[model samples]
Target: MKVVLASASPARLSVLRAAGLDPAVEVADLDEEALLDGATGATPAAKVTMLASAKATTIARRIADTVPEAIVIGCDSMLHIDGELVGKPGTPEQAAERWKAMAGGRGELVTGHAVLRTADGGIDRAVEGHAVTGVRFAEPDPAELGAYIATGEPLVVAGAFTLDGLGGWFVEGIDGDPSNVIGISLPLTRKLLAAVGVRVTDLWESD
Candidate 1:
């Protein structure tokens, strides 16, 4: 059986690799349009968990044959501010704007991951019950926001920032796994990987 990661996020990829796992990569190809259709008062945690599950299930279904006997991991994250879900910024200006609004103030970085496995011809799914992390950002200057956007990192990332890169300086502190801010939490990944009998330590000797 093989282990596959269903995402195109470099941050997630990097995180997994750092944990000594060389799992396969398959993008989730998730579409957020359907998930954000007027939550009407959905909590940020609820919204992101839903999106994460959708992405995981979609990828699991798509790659069923490709890895029929393997475990597939799907993950998604979102920025929550003032009870609003902030997806990835579609444009540079939008990213900059988000940075301005979230710069000085603090917000929650909620990342939800879903682990899907097939056993006995049935699917076993695990939601974010394994891990959830909250991160806070330091005050960012309006000018710096624009500068950060120009780097193009914020364009493809949620919350328009990367806690592992230049954006790290802007974070005064974090309440959870710092890697979670990058996209995926290693500790969480390790825990979930265990359900499939893959230990974080074992990956060190994986081929």
Candidate 2:
């Protein structure tokens, strides 16, 4: 089966490539903020999963006619702290504020994975799930925080931080799968694929 990644995140793309999967990229154009805002009272895990499913289904329906046997994968992530959900900080000030709030604190990085299998221009199988990782942040000095924020890395990433980028220095520890913290979880993706009757190895590129 052909594999398609329904997201534009470079980190997510890099994760799949590192796992030896050469998935075709097709970014889903959807209003993420609107979706999140509309989902009232949903838990962080449920909200992410819902968004993931929407992305996968959107892409799968769009390309099913051309790639009937394709497996479309979609993913979304959020940081849950003190019963609140956080996404991308969107601005330098917001990023700096988020870092200040997160310093010396712990939160759960939740990533949702969804897979949609299409056949003969129609949906065949679908599966969605989420993986949670406990992350602890280090209390960096104000100068260090400002310097990191000036890099502009945190503004575009969920939780206003990254484990595989410049923000790594501020991360004290992590529990559970690290890939999930990067936006996609390989192990969780494998399980979701299996749940939809496709093996993870089947998505690997030909040697």
Candidate 3:
């Protein structure tokens, strides 16, 4: 099956490529504010699942003509601290503040992924369940937090931290999939792909 990625995240793209999956990109600017609204009541898994589904479905509608018969994957992630959803920080100050809060604390980074089949006039599709991973961060001094934020790595990350960047220093360890923190979970991606009868290797046999 042809592969389509319904996300504009560079990290997610890098993860997919590294996994040997070469998928076409069709981005959708999901209404994240609306999506997060009233989400406090949901478990972390449910929240991520909802956001992932919304993103995948939105792109599926947009790319129906361009990639019919292809399976589109949509993914979303969030940082859950004490049952609160934390998203990407839009500003440097916000990034610093979020880091302060997450420092020395363990949290869950839930990644939700969906696979939508655009075949048969977009009538058939399958969405994978939400994937959850646990991460721990050692407490950092204010100076370190400021310095990491200045590097601009935390601003674009879902949990206000990037395990592959300067933020990596703060990571104590992870209890589950590390790729989930980066943006996509490889094991979960493999499972989703195989469930749809396509493996990651199939996408990169030539490349």
Residue 118 lDDT in candidate 3: 76
lDDT of 3 by residue, 107-185 (tens): 9988988877777566375757777888998998878877788888888889898887778899999998888888888
Clashing pairs in 1: none
Question: Candidate 3 deviates by what RMSD?
Answer: 1.7
Instruction: Give the count of colliding residue pairs in each prediction.
Output: 0, 0, 0
- lDDT (10s digit) by residue, model 2, range 69-176: 989999999999878899999999998888878999999999988999999998899999999999999998989988988888999999999999999999999999
Name the runs in model 2 displaced over 4 angstroms.
205-207
Clashes of 1: 0
Question: Between prediction 2 and prediction 3, which has the larger lDDT?
Answer: 2
The candidate with the higher lDDT, 1 or 2, is 2
lDDT tens readout by residue for model 1, 109-198: 888777777655456655453244566677766677667778888888888877888877787777777777777777777787686566
> What's the lDDT for residue 157 in model 1?
84
**Worst lDDT 10-window in candidate 1:** 124-133
Tell me the TM-score of each prediction against the true structure: 0.86, 0.97, 0.92
> Which of candidates 2 and 3 is the stronger one according to TM-score?
2
Candidate 3 segments exceeding 4 Å error: 38-40
* Top TM-score hit: 2
Error of 1 at 13 (Å): 0.2
